[model samples]
Target: MKNWLNLTAVAASVALLVGCTNNPYTGEQQAGKVGVYGGLGAVAGAAIGAATSSKKDRTKGALIGAAVGGAAAGGYGAYVDNQEAKLRQTLLNSGVQVQRDGDNLILIMPGNITFASSSANITSSFHPTLDSLVLVFKEFNKNGINIVGHTDNTGSLQLNQNLSNHRALSVANYLTTKGIAGSRISAYGVGPNQPIASNANEAGRAQNRRVEITLLPPQQ
Candidate 1:
């Protein structure tokens, strides 16, 4: 019984460690997808080990299971890391911001670069950028894409909502035309409700009025 308790404690400790580790590329303390998966793997491994092993081999079983879990988690981390590096290089100085959240990559496209004021039509200048993105999307075909449109609180709620929805649909439609399967893409609009910055100033408002594309990994 003591040995079993000890093994369980060790597994829990490993899970905690993975869950709180720093992100290698961003140097930020994020509860990354790798961490979450690793942690869950550890716990599940320990449980399976305890269930299947003889009393004398319980510790060994638990350790082996934990190692396997960590390895699977590492594979996913590497996949996401490669995708992020490619995106950063391709979007350099393109007025687009790439942010990492857990296992997801978010591309923030400011309204100035994506569309004209109060218009749903994409800017002609942004076509090349979208073309580049489409190439990457084709390369990383497994990841799901989510496009969300946001607007500043300058207009009526109804107007903003309609505009935001139209902008999101426009982008979604463009991606479809470029050969991205519609099944892999989901688009939506949230007008002035999920602001990342204050609407008190022009700069803040500009930040608020943006479109975000998030790349999500396949579920394990």
Candidate 2:
């Protein structure tokens, strides 16, 4: 049964990726969302699939469409718009960067403020930020969160991978304790596989070692 469930999860994810539309403006396949939700390990993907497979509260199809940063349309799009506005207003001046690329909402939390050097333990001071964030999650209640962990290429692949997963788990666990449903959250450690900056310098490395929590609309 477990194996069957895993297979179903992979199949569902693949179908979602393959069915994505192309954004004419950017020329990049909306399949790029696979990099966000699909790249999570099998365990995480299976958990998400199992939790969301029967959920019908939100329209998952809203996330499937053409256009990077394009306006969301229909009911699902309106749902996303309201969530985005709530996040922007709540997180204002909070140091966390909130961005909307395409249909997804990304919350970029920098490593310097979130974790200690080379450690997955969140800093003591970061709790308040998370506490505030959890309130928003409770208020929204219709979206699922994908927590992605990243690291600079300063360490071995295995080490970085472990660190990244641990960091993401830390955030997920903390949020669960603060009231976000565990089933609504999925965590993955991507390590250095995806970096937004150069790893050769301290500044860039700091930028690279970050956690991204993407709020996803409910899946069908």
Q: What is the C-alpha lDDT of each candidate?
A: 0.85, 0.74
Q: Write down the RMSD of candidate 1 (Cα, Å).
A: 3.9
Error of 1 at 54 (Å): 3.1
Clashing pairs in 1: none
lDDT by residue (tens digit), candidate 1, 98-178: 999878999999999999999999999999999999999998888989999999999899999989999999999999999
Counting only residues 3 or more apart in sequence or on different chains, how many pairs clash (N, Cα, C under 3 Å) in candidate 1? 0
TM-score of every prediction relative to native: 0.81, 0.66
Q: Give the per-residue lDDT of model 2 (tens digit) for 125-171.
A: 98888888999899888888999999999979999999999999999
